[model samples]
Target chain A: MTAQSDQTTANADRIIISVDAMGGDNGPSAVVAGIAKSADKNPQVGFILHGPEETLRPLVDKRDVLSGRVRYCDTPDVVSMEDKPSHVMRNGKGTSMWSALESVRNGEAQGAVSCGNTGALMALSVIRLRKLPGVNRPAIAILFPSTNPQNFNVMLDVGADIRADARDLLQYALMGASYARNGLNLKRPRIGLLNVGTEEHKGRSELKEAHGLIAQFTDQADFDFVGFVEGSDISGNKADVIVTDGFTGNVAIKTGEGTASLIGALLRQAFEYSILSRLASVLAISSLDRLKKRIDPRRVNGGVFLGLNGTVVKSHGSADATGVSAAVKLAFKLAQSGFAERLAARVASTVELTQDAVELADPVPEHQKEGQA
Target chain B: MTAQSDQTTANADRIIISVDAMGGDNGPSAVVAGIAKSADKNPQVGFILHGPEETLRPLVDKRDVLSGRVRYCDTPDVVSMEDKPSHVMRNGKGTSMWSALESVRNGEAQGAVSCGNTGALMALSVIRLRKLPGVNRPAIAILFPSTNPQNFNVMLDVGADIRADARDLLQYALMGASYARNGLNLKRPRIGLLNVGTEEHKGRSELKEAHGLIAQFTDQADFDFVGFVEGSDISGNKADVIVTDGFTGNVAIKTGEGTASLIGALLRQAFEYSILSRLASVLAISSLDRLKKRIDPRRVNGGVFLGLNGTVVKSHGSADATGVSAAVKLAFKLAQSGFAERLAARVASTVELTQDAVELADPVPEHQKEGQA
Candidate 1:
């Protein structure tokens, strides 16, 4: 029938997502398994695995889920986590990470996912895809897991650049709102600007300026702007999107990770402190497992590099198959939603474009005549 | 017979610690309970409670621990948490918070502790006791719990001044190291400068200059200098003192508090999910209580403002009797150790004093500064 033919054609022309299948803590096998798992769950998704053909082909073929939907690019080199970004940018032509980005640039894939070095991946993406129009500094956005199981709070400028002016912050707010709409299915996300104190007159001068500019966009962007949130609001159920300069956001992320690890270690110590405690741990382990599942960092392991011409999801370097699968699924969703083009359109519609770094500088007015006493 | 008389006189002349007892969330009774608890454990400690004698005398008389070591400094006003610092400074003559600081300034007490408004307490202390000669901006230091049970890792510039230059950071290192030496009994504490990256080449220009300046003080100051540390090292045992500008430190501190609170909520939810889990929680209640006590925020409830002429410990405004007792204990330890004078001497020993905010501007010659050419 005509319906069967249409379905075959649709399957043949599936959305291809590229993957750098090497350089993660777990080797190429984990990457292949992750792709297979994603492909099984998502029939409309296919992969362009970028790694050595000999290494990837056998691992990929073992999975019945990835029979006809997989493709290989036959890359010779792997971008190791220890390799410097500058070095990779200059000398990494045939690396799997490089090939994956190239696939995105060549339009063979909608986006790319990499489990290699974050710095290297970012460098390669910037070099290949360039930045979107009206974006001064490209920022990395991440979904912070919240109380709501179906949604997450979006935070931007996580670690892309350490500095941000009022203009850059304004761009981040716009970009982050667009992301929330697409990724978290929010029609109008609430945005908050992070600061030391919540009082109206607190924080630095730049933050004050940013606050006014962000407030002006609430009506136009169809979002609610909650002014001057503190560090406590980042993890709590406050705003749907939290914005800050990269330096503060990056430090906060690392600190949260360290604290979570510390708590986990302390829990082990508590459970093993005595024989009776150990017995209690056995009975309570299932409840603890649910709690652990709720806060698992691996479930939300990808950092999306927003404001770029093409989307790139950077998986954690230490990710295993489960973590890698989570990242791949995120990439697939972004590609499926046509998020990059929508983001570009939204940014283009905004009037304020480039940063005012040059325009705002006082170019000491033309040789004023002074009267001597 | 001479030694016995001296002991009697020494008991009568115990070190007097001034406290603002009116404005804590738990009220004057909690403050009285805390002072009594401290007095029971420390016979050499005496308190000068500043509040209305009519309201406080009955509470003080209720405690057997406060029978002989208490003195009342009745004040007509109480500095509420909502009182602005500037308003308090201009019109807070007879306030209990003001009286406590005045006692420290007049040498009637060695140290002062308050669970009132932090900004008001700081303003009053700076106005009355003055800043140390070589100190440009004072900082608030706190002890974060760590791997070693005997000591804690010191973090400074928690929320005193939001801005800091290279010299200011170096000064924090010196002051934080001094605090570690006195508070934790570490002879030569290891110091680490907080940064976005661990590499020497990373972070802002001011941080780069601070790194070189701190390196020069290892032998003269008697400490180990770990080059640069990321946020993950804050709780880890990488260094004894972690120094940063106040803005970053304050945000990190609040973020840690928020995250810890979130995990606590999640843990409670996990344990209450079912009937069997609730029974397991009953059996494991003691172990969990010990774990909770180990990480209790109330246990370490004081933040000491360093680099001032007199030491001031700011307790949490909502502290209960146990929390107040912890703050009083910290105040007693600092007063007993004569930390203020030793810190002044240490700061004076360093030749590099105030921050050079203006002198270090634009070292590059004008000839190289081409714009339109």
Candidate 2:
């Protein structure tokens, strides 16, 4: 194995996660409970719970499993979900989520995990830790819950880059492929451009341009480019990684969330309407539960904001203890993999090639270069 | 009652629905089942099963309930979902779906029903019927399934009018309100702009402009405009009608759909893990079924394409018999309410006022007027 691979394996074995204890709807209690439970199961991993010292002390002291493994960082302020993204980025200096992120940026912790405001986390990351050298924008990549566990779909720019160009899309595809490789341990990640249809000439002008760019990357053997994927393909897991602008990705994820909840509720109602049907539902309860587990949001709460300088995992704002636990696990997995550094290195190398292509396509005049000097 | 309203109401009461028998995944079986079930319940309402005589004739004849109510329109061609929207609109002359839509356009039927390609339906509707005066684009308005049964949310431009301005959003809000009142029988629907945040000064510049226009309408009592709404508020039942450009709306709906399915599958997985859990799942199966019924896609499959000269209902592309039946029922309700005429009149009034406002704000110069002449 290569030295980098050895380091990754070592890091994976000794993962330390910085958890925002004061984040989410239920606060430190749920965070503490989840972290305590998780730490007990994973002896190789450690935790640094960031929150108000007073609040975290009692919770830590009460649990033997947590006290030894989990430490605290004194952060007084808690960034509420309702706070404006700009305001939080400016004023959240001492916030637990901010402090947790700082730990990751400073390399005190391998990864930062938070169930706080999404916009705030995104803005703070951009301002504080900064983007990877060649990354214009970082994308939030989520694995849509899938029936085939082996075929989880990675949807990028899920409320990160609202107005992304073809270059941004190319970066998303590259980053998503890297994520799938490291995070999901896929040998060859199939990259797909999420469009209105699967046709080569489908979608708006922007998507068409993006499709061409992705095709170019695939032709060069960068990743397994699977071409275009439609809205319906998301559920079917047609691609390992699906790329789109944040606006579309955000709405698509939300729509999927709403629809799944609606269907679950519909089935519940149908069983209630008649006694005979209710009994039949009782008989088929195992099958239903099996299906539910395959699509649980709580089980898959952590979504990594890829292309950042450091690993930053975002948990749902409405996440419970179960969701919080999953986020921590995801963070541990990401940190262990050394995925951020690998991605940054890959992007840095590609940037040089892309620059050369750009220069070749439209060479800058000698006079313009002299003027700059 | 006004002459138009009285005539429409009478027609609605005696409305004959022409269903595309060859449309949808389940084919004629589901269509026939839905029609038979509907005809048995609604004695006055009739149906025309449009498809190849061989395919549909036997299905209709087999059901006693469909004996007199269901007739046939001989159309051989079937527009597959995979077909191009433009091609289906231009060349699908004898397609069952096209024929069904034509039945409504030619006034041979009060309304048409189809569970075919949404793109094809939109294209055909725009090309064949022509848009209502002052309407730049026709929009699809879906009543999103909210948690509260009493307060369903209406989302407009759910895949139409890709590039929309403030004027277009205002028009959609007006049309959505009309649909809510007419089709849903909501007295006065509260309109909301689907925005990133609820703050007065949030979202893109276009949203700010649209917000101002909606506020103006609310002040004038045109409809109950309820300010802005975030993604989370969509299922919270805060607003009766949510208006957005089709691009965002389509993405949002699809995301919600994907997520809902994801969650449902997860829940299923959870119940099937172990024997003890399986027993617990069996005990809770009734509750689960009740929940499922509340979120049934079939119950909320039909979405009205508002701002047209006539009522056009788009069924879910993957809709079964119940979904098609709901679409037919929705069309009948809309036709009965005379919503199109009222909507057109309202929009015309608003357009006239807007023109006057523009003239007052920046009057055309003499040179410009002469150039126009």
Taking the tens digit of each residue's C-alpha lDDT, what string does model 2 give over A1-373?
0011112333344677888887688878888887877777788777777888789889878888764566568877999878888899889998987888887877767888888888888999888789998888899999886544574788898887667887788889889988888888887788888886577756677777777777766644357888888776676666888899887787677667766665666677666667766775776666676676667788888889988889899988777778888888888888778888888887887786655444454468989857866
Kindly list the per-residue Cα lDDT of model 1 for residues B90-208, writing each as its tens digit: 99889999998888888778889999987788788888889887788888898876555543689988888788988788889989999999998999899999887787766788888
| Among all candidates shown, the one with the greatest DockQ | 1
Candidates in order: C-alpha RMSD to true structure: 6.5, 6.2
In Å, residue A326's CA in model 1 sits off its true spot by: 1.1
| Candidate 1 residue lDDT tens string, A189-246 | 8899989888767778888888878887887777899998887777877788889988
Q: What is the C-alpha lDDT of each candidate?
A: 0.82, 0.76
Backbone clash numbers for all candidates listed: 0, 67
List runs of model 1 lying over 4 Å from the truth: A1-11, A62-64, A80-87, A148-151, A353-373, B1-11, B149-151, B352-373
* Per-residue C-alpha lDDT of model 2 across residues B326-363, encoded as one tens digit per residue: 88788777666777677787777777666544445447
Q: Pick the candidate with the highest TM-score.
A: 1
